[model samples]
Target: MEGVPGSSSEHECDSNSLHSEESKLRLKDAIKHLEQLLLENDLVAPESSGTISHEAMQIGQDLYKSTVEILGSKMFVETEELIMAESDDEEGQFEEIQDDDDSEQYMLPEKDKSMEYIPLDYKIKVVNMAKEHPKWTLKTLHKQGCSRLKSMKHLYRWEEDIKHGGTIIDKYSIINSWTYDRFVEARVNYQQVTTRNLQEWALSAASQFENFPFKASKPWVIKFKKQNRIKQRKITKYVTEKETATLEEILAAADIFRKQTQVLIPNFHKDFIINTDQTGCQYQSTFNRTLSTQRAKAVFVQHKSSNKISHSYTAQYAMTMSGKLLPLVFICLQEATGAFGSKVKKAVDEFVKIYQNVKVTSSKSGKLTTYLYTQFLKEVLSPYVKHEKFLLLIDSWGGQTNPALYDDIFQDDNNVGTCTIKVIPPKCTPLCQPCDVYFYRQVKNLIKRLQNCSFLIEQKREIASREDCIKIHAIVHHQLSAPIFENMLRYAWFASKLTDEREVFMNVNEVCFPLDILKKSCDCKNVTFIRCAHCRANYCFACFYDKYHPSTCTVPSTSTDE
Candidate 1:
């Protein structure tokens, strides 16, 4: 009786174990199928998500339930071990697949690969080979010596594409998405966009990131523009400043200014009536056009001081209705503490001794200030006026518009009597300001030409320092003060509608650099390089730069005196 009970119980236990193994096998097959689905759809969740998809969750639940049923008594320890082992294997495979997918994401597309572009001549040759031996396979071509022949299928495709007159189709898309985003933002903000700008931006983006398929080439620019539907249009107009009011308002203000100054003009002498303005002058001026070969698409000039072009200083000029420039020019240089250092002050003192007409000062912002304006009045205008009752025309700059600011300078000095100040109407400088209409443009053009001549003749690349600016201004002031420039100054008053008479005048270039002067000899008896505007004499580079003429022209009988 005992042997029968033991035998029956053992039979029941064997049946249970067999059933558990079958269920485990089914669960594993289901898991395999789910893995296949996930792989095909690229649905492998990253470990950082800390969760899985619904299908994966179902698989986990079924797996856990089955393990619990199979090993009921020891389910805790063994089930944990089993699930860990299975997950370890699956995670290893999944991670490998993920790594492969990441690398594929970075790989350049087929059309962007440089190898895809074949020469037209080579394509024609390949087509000719095909025509000669229609039955020969690409393998046969390789055997018969076709250079760069790798894929037979690709060779056949190329011949067909060539027959259809299709191009080789190698092109590029934007590799750095950040660059594209930034480019669109810039365009939306009305920034000027160019192919070179795009190339530079792409290169910069590539430097900061990894695996960016950047191509800073013309072809890439062409393709990118086409892909984005961008077109190059000629810029019809550029807006320098926002309009303050409607057209009628500007005209009315200008008219009011003309009428207000009409009476005072009769009382003041042409030589006594003065217009003063301050303009920003760059340390280094660059030329827009240069001599270049006809075949060249781009022209470049060598400039070692190119980096300093952005820095600027202020220059104040005064002109009279009789077309005469004042003898002195006030220059405000950029300094850190609103003053110059001891060494620079000494140099400036020395410089002023040579060019006695130039007045040099400093401000932290390099702009005209109340104190500097007073200094200019005391140092420059007071000495030259000589007890003249004059009318002063100036723009409505905050520092100059205040009438009380001029009290101390003229009150203490008898030479400069009580003067009248006339402010140009707001927002009408371009229409009613004398300096804006004529003088500033002429001065700037002359400065640019002189700078260019200095570079081309002497191979000088130094930026105009504070002393250099003072010298240049002195030379320019002396040149414009000539009797020849009288008509030019008169034209400025006429252009501003301050005077009814229109005067005919030639510009600085026409007056200074005549063709006749080009063939003359310099003061040093060398071939003429430039006409000295200050001395009205031709000078070679050696005489001008080496001897420091005009700037240091203090001798009695030489080209130094006016």
Candidate 2:
């Protein structure tokens, strides 16, 4: 109770100062604890610690130091461990809550499934389903129990691949094996790989591959166009073994022939070069294709009488390298009797009237004989050539290459400088014969077209008579007349190596015999004529009878052996 001098004031001041210091110390401890908790939980960043006031940071550091000193290093370590364990527990709880939310979101039926979870079994099922229901979309597949296959993009990709000849099964190795086997079979057995063959092979191939997931239709096979083959040319013995003159040999021969001709006839023109060939035209009409139902077993047209007769006329045509087509010489296979025969003769007369160079002869078998060949040379070639030195190209036929015929033409006193004959190599007609190479194909095609026209346009079903055949020939002749065949002649000459250039022969005029002179000079009637089944002989009844009527002669002799 006694008031000492300045003692109360000093005591009060000391107490106030102690209380303020205590408050500051408590605040420091709380901040330090807060920082420790934040650090343990990874909620506070060390980098952001500098944003706190310097005074507050200093107080926190001092409290942390004092606490570390009081509790010792072991106690501090224990406290840190406790804080970390609590923080870990809290994090585990939060993660569990988040996982519950995520599970609920994923489990919802409305959520779209990802393709990552699709099993191989499910993918295969979907593919099989798609095959069964080709019109179904991916959503449809999913609705039909393929829940794993969710995306239409994946489904469309697979569908497109299969649609365009792609297969889900790996059967390429098997296909290649079968193809090689079939190829060998074709090579050894002379078999062709037809569409049916391919279909059969495809069925076998599909059988080998279990679960082949595509239709093996014609269109599907066609899609693999590079793999499947069509229209391949068959390798023939003739193509492989046929003897052809080498380019060098051909060129050399041509040069030698040219030099020899130039020596014999100075400045020999292209018109002087001539080629002759014989082709047969059937009297019967034929069609390449006819109108018929696709399902029909067979289609037929009316068979003409010509078809039953099996008669064909061997037409011998001559052309200059310059393109001048001479009149055709038609050898009919008929006797000079009956309506058909008379009609043939009349038609031949008509042809002769129109084209003065035309010559008609008949044989039981429409083929050229030695006598007929000689007649062609004398009647057709000799008058055309006259005294002009000419080159003649002919195929190597027995009658054409006869030494007697050659001698008769070249050694005749009047024909001493008339012509020279060159025989194309044997079996090389397709390569070397100008007529075979260019003219005959076009001629045959035109004849076929004419026959078709006669049947289809004229509606004639009866067999064409000899007269009709002659008329057809005449029509074809007029259509492919001199002017038209002239270009073909040039092309043939160029193609057959007979001429160096078509341009060199463009200016040559057509060579035609004067009708009056030709008619006066012809002595065909005086020549003896006999018909044979295989060929005809134009020999005098008094001479060359034995020679003309060989063992193959089928004709009965009408003349006595006097």
What is the overall TM-score of model 2 with all chains considered together? 0.42
Q: Which pairs of residues clash in candidate 2, taking residues 3 or more apart in a chain or in different chains?
A: 304-463, 305-463, 306-463
The TM-score of predicted model 1 comes to: 0.54
**Judged by TM-score, which candidate is best?**
1
Per-residue CA lDDT of model 1 for 359-401, tens digit only, reads: 9999987888888988888887877676667889989778888
Off by over 4 Å in 1: 1-243, 294-299, 412-417, 454-458, 523-525, 532-536, 545-548, 551-562
The best candidate in terms of lDDT = 1
Residue 216 shift from truth in candidate 1, angstroms: 42
| Local accuracy by lDDT, each model | 0.63, 0.49
